[model samples]
Target: MIRKTLALLLLGLFAAPLWAADCSTTIEGNDAMQFNQKTIQVPKACKQFTVTLTHTGKLPKASMGHNWVLGTAADEPGIIADGMKAGADQNYVKPGDTRVITHSKLVGSGESDTVTVPVAKLKAGENYAYFCTFPGHAALMKGTLTLAP
Candidate 1:
C-alpha cells in the first residue's frame, strides 16, 4: 500500500503541469486577411481569458487592418454587418454592441492588441465565434472558441 501511494503521488506530481490552466493565447493575422488559429479552448478553471492579436504582415490599417471580435455564432452575421457600417474609426466593431463578448483593437502590420474575455459569460455547449470585422474578411479570418469541460 505504501509503495502504491508513493507511486501515485509521483505520477500526479509529474502530470499536474500537463493540466495546468492555460488562460491566454496569441493569434496572428496577416496581410492575406488570415488568422493563424482556428480554434481556442478556454479552460474551465479560468475565470477570465486573454487573447492577443498580432498583425504579422506589412500593411497599413486602412488596407489590411485586423481586429479580433467575439460573439455567439448566431450573432456573428449581424455584428459583422453593423461593424462594416461603423467603419475603421470604430475598430470595425459597432459601438455599444452588447452582443460582442469582447474584442481587440484594430491592428496594422507589426502591431498588436489584446482583449480579455470573461469566462463567466461563456456557456457550455454554446458556439462562440471570433473573427476579424474588417470588410470582407469574415469569410477567412474567423474561428471558434469554446469553454472546455
Candidate 2:
C-alpha cells in the first residue's frame, strides 16, 4: 500500500502540470531594436495570460529602453502615436488608455518587466498587436497576438 500510494502521488504530480495550459510567455529585446518573437497566442482556457519582457542589451533606458504594449491592431497607430507623446516617464504608454489591454513597464539593459492580460478582454476573431512604444521602435519591433480557442 505504501509503494502504491507513492507511485500514485508521483503520477499525480507529473500529470497535474500536463493538464494545465501554458499561460505565460517571455519576450526578449536587444539593442538592435528587435524582439525575439513576432507573435503570441493566449490560450482561451487561461483566465489570464502573462507576458514578460527582458532587455538583453547593454544600453541605458534613455537610449534603448524597451517596453511591451498590447492593443487592437487598429489601435496600434494611435497607441504608438500617443505613447511617443507620453514620453519615457510613462513607460511610453498613454496614461489610463482604455484602448490598451495591457502593457509592461519600460525596461533597460539587463532589466525585465511583466504584464498580465485578462483573457476575458480578448475575443477569438479580433486582431491584436504588441509593440515597443519607444519612439520609432514600433516601426520595426511589433508582433501579432491572438486568442487561441
Find the candidate with the highest TM-score and give its number: 2
Candidate 2 residues lying further than 4 Å off, grouped into runs, are 1-6
Q: How would you encode candidate 2's per-residue C-alpha lDDT over 10-109 as one tens digit per residue? A: 9999999999989999999999999999999898999999999999999988999999999999999999999999999999999999999999999999
| Runs in model 1 lying further than 4 Å from the true structure | 1-17
Candidate 1 per-residue lDDT, tens place, 1-149, comes to 99999999999999998988989999999998899999999998999999999999999888999999999999999999999999999998999999999999999989999899999999999999999999999999999999999
- In model 2, pairs of residues that clash are none
Candidate 2 CA-lDDT value:
0.96
Candidate 2 lDDT for residue 27: 98
Residue pairs whose backbone atoms clash in candidate 1: none
Positional deviation of residue 86's Cα in model 1 after best superposition, in angstroms = 0.8
